[model samples]
Target: MTPAARTHRTAVLALHYQNDVLHAQGCIRVGLAEDDPARERVIAAAGQLIAGARQLDLPLIHIRIAFRADYADLIQNCQIFRQTAQLGAVKDGTWGAAFFSGLEPIEDREHEFVLRHHRTSGFIGTPLELLLRKLGTRHLIVAGVATHSVVEMTARHAADLGYEVTIAADACAAARAEVHKASLASMSLIAEVGSVASALASEKDSR
Candidate 1:
């Protein structure tokens, strides 16, 4: 293990690693872990990040987006989600709603938990804050699909809530490279945006 993976107080927040978004047969996998070069980079980096976090003994929180079978909790106020409503995207208890096969937490890991959120920001409707507090998280390392959406929103919210945020650039993917890059640039103002290696360095360097 690297020195940084020895004694870090960081909590790794992995978002939207669901099969529906990452797998080849997933409902929206075209621009994610499938054919998109940008997203492919994110997936590769996320694999490394996950390995590093495990070695460092950091708390791992997997956040997924799931809605009720009846779609009662889905917000139809915007067109972006209207498609979800129509297609029944990520309905709970389905294979598509489960975490991607390779990314599920090991059963014996004590500090890891899977959570379901109904919105873009993981903290808005979830126990993420409480878990972080319990883990005494001083820095949050965020990685997930859809950099322009969930990843960016969560990082901003975490920073505003007084936690130092670190965006693992290569661990976040978007439908388009431009959108991904733009979101990262925008979030750099509020959080430290870098590759998985650089983000891990911060964890090692933190007091």
Candidate 2:
């Protein structure tokens, strides 16, 4: 991790909304009810990252996708999920919109993350930057599923904003291994890509 990212409010994004929309098969699978093995693994990986980060006490946060009660707050702004809504997907308060379990989510607690609605890039519609700025976070370590989609897009935005970014390699996943590796390859020259252990191994190095 770059000096900027290692200390700058490192946040590991947790995963949800595992749709088959980008999968080999064109099926929008639901959560545990219609669990996808690949998606489960992705969630499991994210959970492990969250648990471990807690152990490490990294300045972390969590985010989940959602829509307002009227849903009017989103429809026009969202390009991707707007179409998804047409397909009977991602209702506002439904189970489908909830972040996958195993993230060690708190019922009611401090430092909890805010939920976003139809916002693809976590930083786009949310006050993530303001929150980070408040925390004095200029560097970010990002992790989650589907590196090509959400992960890649967010990383690009982070870099453009002059925030040093590192994507934990093993902490994220794509629909397929090829896509995952390809996304990392695309990011390697731009973003520091490595495992969570290797990313934080430097704390060990500093010792």
Candidate 2: list runs displaced more than 4 Å.
1-9, 15-37, 68-71, 76-79, 107-109, 203-207
lDDT of each: 0.82, 0.62
| Residue pairs in clash, model 2 | 169-194
Compared with the true structure, what per-residue lDDT tens digits does model 2 show for residues 28-122?
44222234566555555566677766666655666555556456666555656665555555555665555554564663544446556356577
User: Model 1: per-residue lDDT, tens digit, 1-207?
Assistant: 644323336899989988888877888662754555655565678888888888777888889999888999988887657877776679999998998876777757887788888888999889888878777777899989888888988999999999988899888888777888899999989998888999777677764
Best by lDDT: 1
Angstrom error of the Cα, residue 33, model 1: value is 8.1
For each candidate, what TM-score against the reference?
0.89, 0.75
| lDDT value, candidate 2, whole model | 0.62
- Per-residue error at 98 for model 2, in Å? 1.2
